[model samples]
Target: MPSRSCPRLALLALAATLALASPPAARACSVCGCGDPQLDASDPAAASGRFRLQLASEYLSMDAGTEGAPGSTDHLKQVSLRADAVWSPAEWLSLLARVPYVRKDLTTTGPGAQGPGSSLSGLGDAELGARITLLSRVDLGRGRSHGLALTGGASLPTGSNDARRGGERLDEHGQLGTGSFGPYAGLHYAFSQGDWYAFASVTGRFHTVNGFGYQYGEALLWTAEAQYRLGQRVAVSLGLDGREAWADLDHGLAVESTGGLVLAASPAAYLSVGGGMWLGVRAQLPFYARLRGEQSVGPVLVGGVQYQAL
Candidate 1:
């Protein structure tokens, strides 16, 4: 209950929140940090109850595979508006909520996009979550710190899953949501010294079968990032991410090309603007992909503007 303990406790909660939030893996699905978390970090105007809003444009495209495969290649071009609010009602706890609006166009190549394609434009699944400070930071002089935290949350099935065009069902991948609820848990650890900082996190998400009696499989995601602050307004981050996914199931049958493991690298830059505002851009590229079948993964580009203390 001491006045100085509040900021240290908030720093502990941040350790967990920043772990899985900076550059999520490319195939993390429900566990990806598609919204920016560090968007309004450490703004003097943001004493408590900080809010960060990010609107980003993201794009990803796949490659064509061999013939006779059950699925064909597809490319996704999307524009999404994501909003994240961070409220520190108590020093030892924080509440977070994220909502996104996605407009994605799927273009099929070869046989896949020719028939099983559909456009999705609507509200994506919204997530409500909270972070607890398991370990508060010890703020030594000269800005040295260490902290840890834990996070738990769930996603609501707000997006439509049964989207059809001309009486044909679109692919599950193209749907705005899985039509199923999911739960997420994660842990974070971070260390910072002066202008240099590093963080790591492990996150897991499990999903249930959707309305079509199909499940997209569970995912375990890992992330690590090293960053350096430039002057007072700029930060550069280099991140590595990995994901392991179980094979998807449909009608109790395993989907061959549905799951595997992927490793990716991402780099980002953030520029702080005056009045608790910032701008950022990041790219996620999969360098190693060992999928189950003939599936492939690609890169994602995200550009966003964020605000805090609002």
Candidate 2:
């Protein structure tokens, strides 16, 4: 009887050990909206749902001089903070919201010297939108996938337009808040492997200015990015962006382009650190810039954090 009891106890212990050694299922990839498309489709873990949040900040400064004052020049500085959250309900559906806070200051000198002057404050504008993946990897081919996403949304007028205008009247084009309805759209494509990823997308927005007197017609924007995994926990990317804006008021339209490199390190599977730069065209132009022969260019720095909830 003692020998029979010992055999039963040994069997139970072996079964428990096997169960503890099995790995947990992989959580979905909510950060990119579309899961890693480069992985095998038969893997159940690749189709799971995920939630993501991201926060980013940027700083920019520009200075220009005129021939009359020779040494005299004008300068502007701007700081921006942005946050985004997204929920993936299905492999083909996602909802997103974004908020932005901005601060700006301007200084000028020459004949009418007003001494050095500055204004520092916030300009409020927040946006909400939804995105749908019309096509997934399954629709493309076996082992290969392509995703099509369409986003629609609006920006709420929340920033103060009168924060620091100094004594000079604010131009409608210079005000921070549009005080009117704005619409935007985006399209994206991604190709993924077990852990590597590449993507490209284009986004556009149309703005109808409010009583403040600015006219922002329609703008076209586009971006392309490629990324590779350094190991199981790190990924780095390079990207380029281009934009053309049409002004309805005095500042006509301006064309700007930017290119940058991004470095992202995932200490854990769900958290990441990212930083990049915008090395290209930066400008504020009067509608008829081409006619006036005026152009502005500069560089910007950007940094951010991303968190995903499994």
Evaluate model 2: give its TM-score.
Answer: 0.63
Checking candidate 2 for backbone clashes, the offending pairs are 38-192, 124-159, 250-287, 251-286, 251-287, 252-286, 252-287, 252-288
Cα lDDT tens digits, model 2, 115-167, are 55555556446666766676766422333445666656666777555533457
Identify the leading candidate in terms of lDDT: 1
Best by TM-score: 1
lDDT of 1 by residue, 1-310 (tens): 1223323222222221222232222223333342223322322122345555545555555432322345555555555666666676655566767677877676677654466456789998887777666886656675666767786787789988888888877767667877988787778676766556767777787788888998867877777777766656666777787777787778888765556777778777777566655677777677887776666566666666665543
State how far residue 142 of model 2 sits from its true place (Å): 6.8
Q: What clash pairs does model 1 have?
A: 108-113
